[model samples]
Structures are given as C-alpha cells and as structure tokens.
Target: MSNANKHMPFPELTANEVSNLWSSFLMNSMQQRLLEYFLASTDDSKIKQIIEKILTQSQENINELKEIFDKENLNAPQGFTEKDVRIDGIKIFSDTFILNFCFDLTHLSISTYPIALSECTRNDIREHFQRNIAFTVKIQDEIVELMLSLGVYLKPPQVAIDSEVELADSFMYLNGFFGGSRPLNAAEIANLSRIIHRAQFSKMIFVTFSKLAKTKDLKQHFGKGRDGIEKVLNSLKEVLDKENIPISASGDYLISNVEASPFSDKLMLFFVNTCLGIFCFTMVNQAMTSSLRTDVVSKLGKISDDMKKFYGSGLLLAIKEKWFEQPPQAVDRKV
Candidate 1:
C-alpha cells in the first residue's frame, strides 16, 4: 500500500460505502476468528454446525463485497489479519460473554444497514444494501432467539403485529418518519424547511438513548455515539435552515395501530425496541450530516433529555414487568 494516507485514508465514503467496507471487513474478521475457534473445539457436532453456518454466510458476503469492489473499482482491503482475530482464542458458547459480543456486533451491522442504503448514491448499491439489511436482520433475530433459548438474558423483540399485512404497513409508516423524506430537489429542499425539526426531534431521541444505554458487559457499545450523532444532526439542521426551509421541531416515534407486545414477552420486546432505538438514532445522524443543519443539532441536544427519559422509562417498565416472573414468592426465614 502507498505510504501516502497509509491505512486510514481521508476519502469521504457515502453511508453505503462506509458500511459496505466495514461489514466486509467485519465478516472476514469474524469468519477467521470463528473458524479458528471451531477448529480448536473438541469436534462437537453442535459447535461445528454453528461454525459452518456462520462461515457460509460470511463467505457469501465476502463474495458480494468482491463483486461490489470490482464493479465500483474500489480498492478492497487485503485478507484478514491475525489482529482481526483478537477474539479467536475466545470460546463462543451459548451463554458466554463471547456470544454476547458476537451478537452485539451483528446488531451493529444490521442497525447500520438501512442508514447506509438510505445514504448511498447508486440505485444498484442501495438495492444491494437493502437486501443485505433484511438478511442481517433475520440473522440477528435468529441469533437473539438462540441466545434466549440458552438462558441468556438477551431477548428477541416482540412487536405485536395484528397480521403480517398490518405489521408491514405499520412498520413502513412508522419507520418512514425517521428514514426521512425522499431525496430533496433544490426547489423541494427550499420548501421543506419545517420538516427539519421533525428530523431533529427524531435525532434527539436517538442520541439520548445512545447515551442512556448501559455500557457494561453484554450491552451495545456505541462508542461516543451521542456526540457523533449530535454533530450530524446539527449539520443537517443548519443547512435546511440556511436554505430558508422551515426547520420544524423534532418529531416523536410515529405510533401506529399495531399493538404493543404483552408483558410476558418483555425481554424479547426490549431487544427489538433497543434495536429500533438504535436505528432511529443512526437515521438522525445520517440526515443531520446530509442536511448540514446546526440549529437542528442544537435542538436535538436540548430535547434529547426528554426523549431519553421517555424511552428509558419504557425500557425500565419492560424490565419491571419481567421481574414479575412466576409472581415472586417470599421466602420465610425462621430464626
């Protein structure tokens, strides 16, 4: 590699480019580590099955990345390195910390996929990203469910959809609020000022949740997530306002007729809700960066506390409901 700009270059990546490159790298990194771990296992059938399944998926994604790199004439990084396999020596058991780490990484990839698709320039790339996003989500849900079955506290999200049909529509409309409006024409951009606030408020909820999430073991590690998002939200808010768009205040999560899952499934519900929370946060970050709005960012920071409190309460309530498992019997201690 050329010494100029060395490993980390300053080239600006579209959201798609950034995620594609990162996911490709991560898949390669994960595959290598997983293979090593499996080889070290005592030839257990269950472990082998899990290893083969994940390795197969990684190979598929690797092939896809190669195709994208070749078509785009982008330089793909070299093969995976020893350093990439930092966790190779670690065992990934159903209830172990390594399993949590792997699942968290999967969540990161899935959460960012939609953002990248929304930000990418080319239609083909966007479509590819969208497909990958869906695949990743399915994989994530499966992984979480597996963990839950193993008695890991990590639960699958249970958004109570009436029917698949109803769920589809609810997801579309609700997600759209954060996904942002269609790409703006110059004239349309000029007229869409008020919508900026809606974006800001959405961003506010995202950043606040990012900050509030517990960072200890088995939790999502966003790494300066709040600051990074605020920067992006401010940029978008500023640009929209500069263009005389009526930068509206931040909007709320658009609730639909879709019912909330019952308290019995609180654990799984939290898993899904947390993932959605992260998605909303990322979209806000992307939109803010794309729009270059300072005012929106500022407002986002100001209002994030309220949003955090709102969502935080939801998470706590979910946990509280879980505490009712088997109706807690009081132990009688006779001295």
Candidate 2:
C-alpha cells in the first residue's frame, strides 16, 4: 500500500483528555465541605430527608469513580483548595447563596456526565453513566416542583419547531442513529462534549433552585430534569468512547461567586434556573444535528422541549408568585 494510503493510529493523550480535570478534582473535594455546610444550615424536615438521600448517592458515586480510576491505573488528582472556588460575589452566609452553590455543582455535573459517557467503549459503562444522568435529571425536576409548590415559578423558553413535522422527523432520525455504526471524528466528539457540558451547567442552576424552593413540587420537577439530562449525557459518552475520544478535565467550567446568589424563595430560584436552562438548550439545539447522529439529534430535540416546559412552568409560577415583571413570549408546544 502507498504510504499515504496507510491508516494512521489515533492520537494518544498522556495527560487526562480535558484541561479542567484538575478543576473538577478540586471542585469535588470542595463538595464535601459544601455538604457539611448544608447539613448545618437547614432545619426543615422534608428538605433534610432529601438532602440525606442525595448525600448517600453522592458518596457512592465518588467511591465508584475512585474504583474506576484504580482499575485503569489512573491517578486521581488532588483538587483545588476552597480558596480556589471561594467567591466574594455571592454572599455565602445567605440561604439563597447556599442554594445557588448547590445548583452550580449539580448543573456542572449534568454537563460532565455526558462527556465522560461519550468516552466509554463498553455498554455496561454507558448504561451506568446513563443512570447517573437520569438521577441528576430526577433531582432537578424535583427541585422545580418544590419551588412551584412554594409559589416560585421559572419561565420556560420559546422553542420554534413544527410540532407534527418535528415529531415525525425526530423519531425517524432516531432510528437511523441507532441502526448505524455510531459516527466518530475529532470534531464530532468535541461537539458532543460541548452539548453535555451545556446541559450540566443548566442542571447546576436547577440544583440551586432546589435548595431554595419551599415546596415539594418544584424540587421534584428539577430532579426529574436532572434524570433526563443524565440519560442524554450517558448516551453521548457511549458513542464518543466507541469512537475513541473521551472528554476529560479540559472541558469543565470555572465557577466563582459571580454566578452564585441566594434565592429568597422558590420563585427567585426558578427564575435563575430558567435562564440557565434556556442558555443550555440553545447550545444543545445548535450542536445536535440530523447529519452526524440522527438518533442523538432527535433525542436532544425532544429533551430541549422538555427543558423548555420546565422553564415555562417556572415562569408561570413566578407570575403567580407576583414575581413576573412581564412574561416573555409563550413557548412552542410539542405533542
């Protein structure tokens, strides 16, 4: 064979794939401290029960990650000091601030889960990560529902899709993606990672709302959203890993107090989260295409509407809370 015709080997990364690995390691370290702070601050019984349940889940995930690293001969990096994440912008002492902090972390998780899933080659690993994504979505939906029950509403986004056409096209495209050899290229892998990251940040906003929401319904809505995003992230990860491009530390976000703020009540929290979800949905919508992975695109489009509804519900609740200055244009409804 001609030298030019010879197949080239995939590029090997000596360090972890993403640059933000160190940041993530550090952030996870800080989560323990944050959890401790939350345990001491809230006295509400229902909220306490939910917190405990989540804490257990978080602990298990950490252990599982550590085991994965050990089996792979990978060394986990020591994370950043609290000072690295500490921001003066959001007053840490306020209830709203604490809630916002949790939201940020959860949102980030939503983003990272898919990227990691994209890198895995095995079905078992993909399924495991997908479950994690679902858990996150469930948590986010719960948070939103809880906020709504408390009279806090987050406004949903205005999505523009021909309902009938989109529904039919989406399902048809999804079949194509599942039937084919999942496409893999450096650009495609990067795009998938971007979609996951966008979703994660969006979820962080919902987590923040959960902390501040007064009722069970808003909280439930946010939690459910987390579950859905988690599944998408997991699927993305599976495809990416099969293609041999796993996202690592390089793709994470840098959170400071600027993005942190206390929600005075469920309404305030929903308002913030709605904005975050819209931003994320836009990115997901843009990155998702019928060309590369039709199944993924269709799935993403459906989820985009799901999130939009969450945002819309939050907005309506905000109006009920007497919190709406003026409602944005009504969002497109999907069947």
Summed backbone clashes in each candidate are 22, 76
lDDT values for all models: 0.45, 0.52
Per-model TM-score versus the true fold: 0.38, 0.41
Candidate 1's TM-score reads: 0.38
The Cα RMSD of model 1 versus the native structure comes to: 20.0
Error of 1 at 228 (Å): 18
Candidate 1 lDDT over 110-188, as tens digits, reads: 6666666767765556666776677667766766665566565422222223333323233332222244523233333
Highest TM-score: give the candidate number. Answer: 2
TM-score of 2: 0.41
Compose the digit string of candidate 2's lDDT tens values, residues 1-335: 34653454424322333222332333354455455445565555545554565556666655665564565455655432333232233433344334434555566567766776676544445555687678778877665565456443333322233344323334433343545543343345556676765555555545545554555766676676666667767766776656555454211223334234333453333334433554466567666652355655666677677767767776766566654433122246863
